[model samples]
Target: MTTSDIDESVRAELDRLRSSIDNIDAAVVHMLAERFKCTQQVGHLKAQHHLPPADPAREARQIARLRQLAESAKLDPAFAEKLLNFIIAEVIRHHEQIADQPGERP
Candidate 1:
């Protein structure tokens, strides 16, 4: 094939790969939204029960479990841990907010 034809072929493949990545990104956002919705309810319950916003034991277990999963999937364990930490931080923030609201007691 000519050089110009090879360049066009490469561009086409890259575009296809990018399109798949975009779709995966959208799926990840939607999944996170769903997960946060569930966590919101948990936060409200915790607030009513006067439980602490952060659970260190659960967080530790989750980090370890996710790291294992990432390794098994051939992805970077550190990256997975960072992502989970970010999500956990947001969840704790929401829980704290719930706890601060008045009339949370049962």
Candidate 2:
């Protein structure tokens, strides 16, 4: 049913729930930023050590770990895997860029 067709009490509850969702979204963004910052450092380290930008074994292990965590959290494992895959792809890209810049600091 549409919010406009709902009563005041229901509308108020919906508003409250939406506000909580918004706050969670903000927190997620900040957490991601923190994660990326760490990943950037990892990229720099890998670059300096002449490591490959992508680590298939580590990526597989991480995906499995995240999927298990998602299952425990009652979230969709496939969805969580997709999200991590996206993030991993971006991280690999960043790492490749860092590797290309031989002497640049992150």
Candidates in order have lDDT scores of 0.95, 0.94
Per-candidate TM equals 0.90, 0.92
How much is 54 displaced in model 2, in angstroms? 0.6
Model 2, range 1-106, lDDT digits (tens) per residue? Answer: 8857899998899899999999999999999999999999998999878788999999999999999999999999999999999999999999999889958544
- Candidate 1 Cα misplacement greater than 4 A, ranges: 1-6
lDDT of 1: 0.95
Top candidate on TM-score is 2
Clashing residue pairs for model 1: none
Give per-residue lDDT, candidate 1, residue 95: 95
**Worst 10-residue lDDT window, candidate 1:** 1-10
